[model samples]
Target chain A: MKKMNNRSDVAVKYLLISKDGNALMEIGEKSAGIEKQIKIDGYDIETIVGFPNIEKKEQIVDGIAKIIELLKNGEKIFNDDVLIEYVDMIINEKSIDEILYFTLKHIISSNLAEKTAFFILNDKLLKLRGVVYLKRDNEDIIFENRAIKSCQIDLSNRGKIADAMFFDKVVTVNYSELPGKNIERYFDKNTIIIPVYNIKGVVGVVLLEDDGTKAKDDASLRLVSRLVSLGINYSSITKQLKLSKEDVAYFKESIEVSSTLTHMGKITASVAHEIKNPLVSIGGFAKRLERYVSDERGLSYLKIIQSETTRLEQIVNDILTYSKIFNIKREKVSLYSLLMDLEEFFKDELMIKRIMVKINCPEDLIAYIDPRKFKQIFVNLIKNSIQSIENDGEITIDVERVKNGINIIIRDTGDGFPIEIIQRPFEPFVTTKEAGTGLGLSICHKIVSAHQGQIWLDNYDDGAMVKIFIPSEGEV
Target chain B: MKVKKILIVDDEPNVARLYEDYLKDYGFEVKSINNPHEATNEFYMFQPDLVLLDVNMPDKDGLTVLRELKKVSPNVPVYLLTAHDEYKRNFNALYAEEYILKSRDPKIIVNLIEKIKE
Candidate 1:
């Protein structure tokens, strides 16, 4: 205003006009370290002449360097639209290794660090199960070491990797500063341990190593880690969904077969007694004639007649068993006691076949079921297993409690189910054996269904396996 | 003490004949009523020590016959012998002494009847 003679104030005005076209500025006083305004042409300017705050100058320089880094990062990210596109395109990649290698390669190419690695966690054991590492060298190459892949981060022994997982965030650590830290072995410089996580929690960790001076954008690194998490989670979800779909399809088919068998059962139940009465008469008459027939030929003929009638009787009984309907009278039955009774029941057959029966039931385990019907299932299953095994084999009945249900597994060291029969094992009149009415598995299916349980058959390498899962409390 | 006289009510003729033959062979006096409608009359006429009743019949169900027979001779033990076991849960069947499946061998029935004392 009055022919200002301050050189620093004039320089401030020129700088503001050149940069922002605004001259309202404040500068610190050299002695007081307090800000004051200097007006020029209806505007103010900033002064730095004898300002004694050397800390302020260093702060400005640091601020400028950060801005420059931000601009450079922004440019790199713009060019990395391809990375975003690659992430979007490779999301459906079936093999996670391919995606991990591609991502590690891309990250290494970005020059964010001297080295990049992805450490995948084995969710079961909480250990590092795999690693995909990329490093800058004479030629760009991605490699993995079995030893590094097996590295287990001892969370108790806190380090950058453990902190990243425990805090559920990115952790930066100077490798040289950490004495006796496990993470130092992996990196020769600074490390940014970024956690890869999803709704299920931290599934993996990402290690970014660089010279201590290189700047890292934590937010961008987090975004990349998230993308990697999404890829892994997507593939796992896809596998589970595929298995669930197959299970649904299988149950749907089982239901259709059950409905058809129910109709046949209804028809069979109506006439079963009508057929059984005559069988009893014929068998009774054969027995009566057996006393008078003295000749061996006559006796043999009578035996044939008696045996055929008995066979007919058994067929009718089997059919009626299949058609029988009863409510699932659920009660808390001691499974250990029930299995023990079955072991006693088949004691003779088991001894005859020289089969070792192993009942792996926890004594305290109890299930809500219709005791009689439940017993019938085990009887039929055990008998089938005994018949399948010729001699000197093992039958294992393992029972365990699961989420909302009880699982019963019966494995027999015998010829597995014929492939054709395994497909429709629960269908009525389906049998792999000769002379049976083929209603055993059908009866088992019906009984399990009445309890709103699931029974499936599988063949192990050396034997047949029957798996049954029912709610702890019977659903029906 | 042995059961001297018994009655069997069943709709099936051959099944009744088989029971009759088997019971006769066991040396117990026995009567067979082929019709459930005529069961109460036969029960009253026979005044037997025990009655064997079938569950299913053409004109009248055996549970109703069982109720009538119990009304006539409340003290006489009635055993339900039926091909179908569903009737064992019927309220009328509670009056019966035992529920035996008809599919059992006739000799088993004979042994069961012989175990009854009068």
Candidate 2:
């Protein structure tokens, strides 16, 4: 057996003996005499292998021919049908992680590497999640190492690797010349890192390390890049599936609630009709009785009937007012104008109840809202407050602009809502008052949500406060 | 002027009778129908100068009847009777002469009818 001295010299000698043997001989003229001297020094002639002087030339030629034949057979075997069958096996696998594990194992086996790992990118922290080794005996492949540090290297200056991966592409660190960071904490001693990217963005990385020099070859890097891209595409498809499931759930809930509202609307309309006809008859008869009746008892009874009929009318009005849903007609409305209109409409009621109403809104303060809907919202709030307070209680309406939005607060000297009612005051059929329809605050909530605003009730020590926050027009 | 004969169409007999008696006191010859199905024939036969139509009926909705009345006599003024205030906007869209809330005192309706007669 002949021993080879110095691997580099062996590689050079093999290259010189190849197709460019004559050119290499001219370059080796200076060392020609040294080769002659080595022959005289009793070096074994059979051990002295050169690129051009091959002892087993015929065997090498035969091996190459066989490899070519095998390649052609492999191509025929993987014709479209076979290729599709292989792809279906990978795609139908229960988990993508299992497919990735097998793929990493295959790469390490084919490349004859010491170790290989696949790290999936964590979107939340922009970091690696797990490491899958190919043949290495490291059982803790998926363990998170917090001590690992990363250093960003600018490859733009290096022309060879400049456009290899785009600017956003992650490059693997050469462990031998690792940059000034705790890079070794992430990978083995001799590893090559390659980024994984899908159409959307970079999703993961692949690391290959080995004792052999072939691990850093360009061909190996290119093969690993293609596999990473396939893995990233699979991950993105999974993410889209999750989002579609959530959307389906939300759509079902919306359909259920809308149907409930439609049924309620129909029932209310019919009941209102039944109640009104008899009410009109009673009012008409009461009016005629008042004209003919002279006794105090008879006159008082007629007055009672008239008052009761009026109360029933108010109840019907409230029901109708709360059930209607209107689209927003956004327009710039002055707070001063709204307050003035409300004050005029409620003036008589205020006088009769002896409630003192005060407005503290700014004259120039403006907000964009559906005027009709907002009018009803504010009126309901104010009326509820007035009804809660005792006779002579004070009510104040104030509007102010703050932090890119407008806040309208209505405060009244009334006993605050009970603790139980306060928690879910905006829910339908939740009322504190004897004559409450329980839909007042629910309607208010729906209106505020439609306007892209918020309405909340605050319980103060002395009174109750209702505050409305509406985002300013043109302001997100 | 034949007192500008008025027709009252409602599903409730008592409601129909109330309007008929009240409008008669105001010197108007009023015809009334409690069944909405019979409204189309009676409406044309009466040749009413104005019609008071109730919005909620068992056989047919008031809006359908309103459309039929408009086809029969587009020029004749029709007033819709809605018990609920929520229907006010919908009533406005019907292009009726006016909307009469049923919850209001019958005296208001009598006064409104007299004003419409003018």
Candidate 3:
């Protein structure tokens, strides 16, 4: 593979890998010169960590001198031989961030450079968020600052730093010392700025102080970039996985809370049933006493007792109904007979209001239903229709046979249901009337549901149109 | 004509007495037993034509008592009464002639039992 040119204008030769971490081709960067294929067999990376440079044929004498000195102690040792073992040791150490820190530290220490700063892009803002700077003072290697206060390197061609990053290639901007160039201001006189690319695009820049020698330290520069890229990718993935794990925990907690709410609902239903028993006993005894009380004052007081107890009874019934433990007795009934009886039952009110009642049903339409419960469904619906008419309104009841069931439609020539509550009319305590219990539709809905049937309001502009479907067969 | 006899078994003493009072007023010989264990004994002694059994009770529930009572007198009619609709609504109440909730007005219950007598 062709290695990045150490003689590039940038402080370091940057080889851009794809931002997604796939291809090693830098996006916009042109290596200052044609790439030279790496002579891997000539220079082993391990050699620089311990022994003198042996890749330079001119340094053969120095390499030999180092070997002879080790041999004088009855050993022939070479750093190149230990390259595999040392790389494994450095990787085995966990805390990859620290590994990258020390890996870069080791590279700078070996190359004998004065300063280095690693800059990684914040993809969201398209700016450098991290500036990992290190310094070497005599024998002490100090990590002076990893945070940059004003580290906004624009990903544009405004300066050399922006140009190298935006172009997705490394450019070594040469200067005797730190220049006014945006990225150059952070480095020493001789700096090498390299581009670090993730799999898909250029992500950051890595700048190292060049030793200012006639011949640059090309061997070590080539390897440092590889180690630094690997470290950055590892840190990004770990952070994302941690955030995802927290999201999963929050999801599980909501499920637990909802389950608890369901349990509480069951308990409340049973408690309401118990309360109804005493309420019944209280109301029953009060009514039985009304017959004995003959005075006007006593009778008027008894009337209050009678009305309030009935209202309280209805609320208990609603709670029990929601709990869903009620039973029904099924019997075959003709739909025509039920409607005729309902008409007769409401004859007085219809005559007084001068409202016409129309029934459209076949004589033989019959189904097995709990007569009382089925009657309640129609009564609740018809009563609401009657109340809606301001004057001589008409109610039309239509029944037709449909698939596996009967469809009953009650259309009234009155003001249609208010648009605000039309969508969910069956919800408990939803009513337009001031004196309504607000559970009429909910009760009707419950009765239909218990019969394993569907009931809904058919849209109409002039009047309210209700549609009901009950299976002809008994589910029991 | 011989007057019909009715036996009532309930866990609550007040409720049992309440039924006894209403049944006596309906022109029937009425007996109330609060304990399920004593219910069988009362059944044999009173030899009631009708049995009004509470669905839930101490020691033995109404279902258990019904099974025991039926084993002794399989032909007699037994009605189940419950404080709530849940027990009466359950299909476990299949053996009962009728299951009624105690939450209703007492006069309705009296009228229902009178019809069962005929």
TM-score of chain A of 3: 0.40
The 10 consecutive residues of candidate 1 chain A with the worst lDDT sum are A10-19
Q: Please estimate how well model 3 matches the true structure, expressed as its whole-model Cα lDDT.
A: 0.63
Better of 1 and 3 by DockQ: 1
Indicate which candidate wins on TM-score. 1
Instruction: State, as a TM-score between 0 and 1, how close model 1 is to the true structure.
Output: 0.50
Tens-place lDDT digits, model 1, residues B53-118: 887786777777776776667778888877766665543455577888876666776667657752
lDDT score, residue B109, model 3? 61
Q: Which residue pairs clash in candidate 2?
A: A17-A51, A17-A52
Off by over 4 Å in 2: A1-266, A289-295, A348-358, A391-393, A473-476, B2-4, B43-50, B61-78, B84-99, B105-118
Better of 1 and 2 by TM-score: 1
Ranking by lDDT: 1, 3, 2
* DockQ score of each predicted structure, in the order shown: 0.10, 0.09, 0.04
For residues B1-118, could you state the per-residue lDDT of candidate 3 as single tens digits?
1338989998777777777877787788899988989988989988998889998774787877876686678667788988766564332254567777776766766666667657
Native contacts recovered, each model: 0.27, 0.24, 0.08
Chain B TM-score of candidate number 1: 0.90
TM-score rank order: 1, 2, 3
